[model samples]
Target: MPKLQNIIVLRTFAIIAVVLYHCYCPWLEAWNWYKCEYRSLYSFIFETVLVGRMPLFVCVSGYLFSHLYLDRGKYHEFGNFLQNKIKRLLVPCMLFTGLMCLILQLNYVENIVGYGFHLWFLKMLFFCFMTTWLCAKYIHQIKLDIIAICISIIMMFISMPKFLGIGQYFKYYYRRDSRDNGDDAR
Candidate 1:
């Protein structure tokens, strides 16, 4: 298979693994499958299936971007490349976000938060591509591609904590009224 095909397969598998974990883990809890306690096997499966997926995805993204960099030669075609990338990324993001927002507003869906969370990936990828494009365009002194990749990795690590924190915050706040104590004091 081609490299692009491999990348697509890897990314699709990662996304499927993550989504499956989210979907079925609650069923495992509901069934009391491990005596309501954590198991090493469960931990292993979780780590194998979900924990490493995003790293693989990011690595694939970096590999693809490297190929793009080689093809575009870092200097001449950067603007066109950046514009094409932004259009590809942004158009779908805005359409989906707007559509979901409208559906939630009209139907009063309680899972709007869950549906809307996918936009975070779109936004992050857009920023990553934009940063890579800028480095390719202006910062042509040194090997800026190396700098861009390193910066992307660092940003991903730093952003992971913030992402988890935001998820936790929303998880708590959305269910605040469902708490046993009914304490509104945050």
Candidate 2:
């Protein structure tokens, strides 16, 4: 398969896993499926499938980023590439956030704050792209592939409570109300 095709497959799988995990977690909790008498083997399937779903998505993202930005030729294409990326990332983010906010106002959803949560991923992606670009431009001679991976790992780790307190703050303040329930809460 072509590289682009591979990326697409990976991206699709990651997205599906995330959606399934999110959807399943609620069902699992709402029905107390885990505690069901004579729990079926499907319970094991659900537990295994949804476990670490977000990390799989993150790994796929990292893989795609490596494929895109690690090469010298791609670095030369940075201007158009970055512009396209910003448009692709930011436009949908803005549109979705606006639509969700409107839905909340119309009482289609309970929390406007929660609907705005999807923007967090886009916002973080924007910042990551910008930071990577800056590092590539000004910090030439530094091996950016290693740097990118390191930075990505660091960012991911910092967003965890075990390391930096920043992650905890982000979880509390920036997380959406829809995710406020402990099961789906990031």
Candidate 3:
């Protein structure tokens, strides 16, 4: 599939936003929220990125997927594609996160398994592909392209709030988020 220029531009900005957040976000640590450096500015930037960054990546993914498989009617080849993703994305995700768990010996094994440590995005991508393939394969009544779009929309509706919260949640931590942090944090 040919790359979309707008997607490439969005991806470039998203990468820059992630780098900036990690390097300079005011909430350097999670202990207290209101006492951070750039309370308003960093939170605003971070929230804006949170709202659209990953969704942009997923939208580009859907575009490429439509071009490669759905547009080309390569449904028969989906098995190979899924296997490739398992090898390329899921296998590496498990291996690396498992290694980290082994080395760190953290009690939060669920975290490693559920979220894949620092590889969460890759794991999520793998799941996204799997979900798309499954929906396409089983729900043969609907056209693959339409089904894919519908499913993606549903996913966005369900997932957008969580990602948004991950960005803006810190801003409310001192008041609301902290109340939830009562026992588990210690």
**Whose TM-score is greatest here?**
3
Candidate 3 residue lDDT tens string, 63-174? 6665666667764567788888889877886678778677768534564445445555566566566666676667774576576566445544342222312322222211
Q: Which residue pairs of candidate 2 clash?
A: none
How does candidate 2 score on lDDT?
A: 0.51
TM-score of every candidate relative to the true structure? 0.54, 0.56, 0.59
Candidate 2 lDDT, tens digit per residue, 41-102? 54466557555545455556645665666652464467786787669876676677668667
Better of 1 and 2 by lDDT: 2
lDDT of 3 at 50: 56
Model 1 C-alpha lDDT versus the unseen true structure: 0.50
Q: Write the per-residue lDDT of candidate 1 for residues 81-115, one digit (tens) a residue.
A: 66776687656756776675676463313323232
> Candidates sorted by TM-score, descending order?
3, 2, 1
**Model 3 clashing residue pairs (backbone):** none
Candidates 1 and 2: which is better by TM-score?
2
Q: What is the overall TM-score of model 3 with all chains considered together?
A: 0.59
Model 1 residue 60 CA deviation (Å) reads: 1.1
